[model samples]
Target: MQQLAFYQSLWATERRRPGVPERPVSERFDAVKADGYHGMAIDLGAMTLEQARATVPEFARTGLGGLLTAFPQSVDDLRPAIRLAKDIGSPFLIVIGQVMPLSVAGMIPVIREWLALARAEGMPLQFETHRDCITNDLFATVQLLDAIPEMRMAADLSHYVVNREMLYPIRPEYRALISRVLARCDSFQGRVASRNQVQVPIGFPQHAKWVATFLDWWTEGLAGWRGRAGPDDTAIFMCELGPPEYALTDARGDELSDRRQEALQIRAMVEDRWKALGA
Candidate 1:
């Protein structure tokens, strides 16, 4: 049977509220486990290798599965992260390559090099579709995928929604492009976005249409994964609602909505989609 595992983002636990101290790693791990998450994700994009390494013990203590999202500043920067992920028993590493190349031709070698390195290290790796990285532009990412058919991606389409400033009733061309990306996406992340905003409150009335758009994309992505994935294969759907700037804040620097509640709601939506697949 193909199984769907939901993972919580450790970085999302960050409140970054004024005068509010950060929660300890153990406490975050406890909360995730208690919430019934199958695993947790650590973002090297936001944390250093040492900082990410420090959480290994907590992951073990809680008996939770782990995933690492790496922001490799250089092609070789991914090497250490890969080693650490293997050491911590992470199933795979998600690469958000910070090394930006100016043109599509310029980007191919960089991606190929990193993919080759991951293979050499015997690490399962997926390039993330994100902003401010190698796969920054939607058109560029489509070009890269066409050029490198073997490359797999962790789809975080919120970035594209914001990047393209996509309008509701998305243009046919845009929808087709997203379909292409979803076809090759090996994993998915949950974060709804509108044309102007990167992260919107899912339950907000004004954001309902955007939320519906994201749900539809996720449903299509999950169904595509099931079509190709073998029996006993497990796919991870990450609820990665971010914090602070990635998350909207009011004048007092307080989040407008309950992030934890939002995460749970997104997780449930994905879970329902998975169940509907009968996988």
Candidate 2:
């Protein structure tokens, strides 16, 4: 049957305290499993490949799902990342391509090659909408999607919002553009962002509208996926509320909200909306 699963990002747990040592991967996995997440996702940009490989046994021991987000700098760079993801037995691989091609036509071949390689390796892959990558620009990404019909995306609306410096009470043109994005999403990401900030505390009074807006987008995206996907397909919605820098910080450089709690809240919100989509 079609279903959705939630994951917590390992990077989200970073530097929760400035002077304190980071927790071990085994301990982190235990915490993720205890927190009732179905999986944990590791960021390649955050750790060396050897470091990522070291955690494979922990994922095996915990029996939780696994996912990898890769930052590939070239067409051939995806190879090892896919292999590591296979070791973790991830449901899919997310690529934030660092190969910046100035034009859409220039990008087409790079993306097509990555897709072909992943398909040959028997890995499911989707490019993530993020900053400082090939899909970084909103206009360029939309164009790339149209140019390559098979190119699937894992939507992280936070980057796009901040990228566009989107104004609130979103204009009709802005909503239309976002609708095109939602229509093409193969998966959804969790984070509430205003045009000014990349990540904000979800429960704050000022952030409520943005929260509501994100939920609306996710609901529309998932419902659309349900309509098109086969009965047995599964959907993944990862809660990637990142650490300070990604998170809003106080003057002291401390996080303004409990990120773990916010991640869970995002999961709950998505779960509620997914249930109401009807089987």
Candidate 3:
């Protein structure tokens, strides 16, 4: 049977509030495990490979899985992360390639190199569709997908929505492009965004439309994944509600909403979507 595994972003645990002290790593892992999360995501964007490796024993101690989100600034940058991911028993690594080439043609060789590296390491790698990354532009990403048929992606549609400044009742062209993306996506991330904002409170009444849009997309994506996945394969959906600037805050720098609750809600929503697909 196809299974669904939910992960919490370790980076999202940062409470950058003025007076609040950050929780210890063990406590954070305990909290995630207590909340029924299957794993915790370690972001290499903010931590070194050595730093990421330190958390491996903690994950083992907590009996929870670990996932690596790598920010590879160059082709060679991914090798160490891949080795670390394999050493730590991570199911896969998500790459947000910071090595931007000038054109789609220029990007081809870079992507091919990384994919080859992942294969050689015997680790699964998925390029994330994110802003400020190689897959930054929506149109360009579509073109790249066409150019590299073997490329797979981790869908974070929040970036594309903001990248295109998508309007209400999404345009046909944009919807088609997004459909193409969904078709190739092997995993997905949870975050709601409007045309102008990267992360929005899904439960807020003002953000209802954007919330609905994301849920619908997720449902479609999950259904498509189910159709293609093997019987014993599992689909991973990460609840990555970010911290500080990625999260909206008030005058006092306190977050406008409770991210932990929002992340749980997103997890529940995805679980429901997975269940809706039947056994």
Residue-level lDDT tens digits of model 2 in 1-279: 898988888898787667878998889889999998888898998899999999899888998888999999887899999999999888789999999989889999999999999999999888998999999988888888898888888989899989999988888888888888888888889999999899999989999999999999999989989989999988888898887778878798877888889888999989999998874
Better of 1 and 2 by TM-score: 1
lDDT of 1 at 29: 91
Whole-model Cα lDDT of every candidate shown, in order? 0.91, 0.89, 0.89
**Every candidate's CA RMSD:** 0.9, 1.1, 1.1
Q: Which stretches of model 3 miss by more than 4 angstroms?
A: none
Model 2: colliding residue pairs: none
Instruction: Give the TM-score ranking, best first.
Output: 1, 3, 2
For each predicted model, how many residue pairs clash, with residues at least 3 apart or on different chains?
A: 0, 0, 0
Candidate 1 wrongly placed segments (more than 4 Å): none
**On a 0 to 1 TM-score scale, where does candidate 1 land against the true structure?**
0.98
- Candidate with the greatest lDDT versus the true structure: 1
User: Which candidate model has the greater TM-score, 1 or 3?
Assistant: 1
Would you list the clashing residue pairs of candidate 3?
A: none
For residues 1-279, what per-residue lDDT tens digits would candidate 3 score against the true structure?
Answer: 889999888898878777889898789889999999988889988777787888888888988888888999888888899888876678888999999998999999999999998998888888899999999998989999999998999999999999999998899999999999999998899999999999998878989999889999988888989899899998889999999899999888978899999999999888887897774
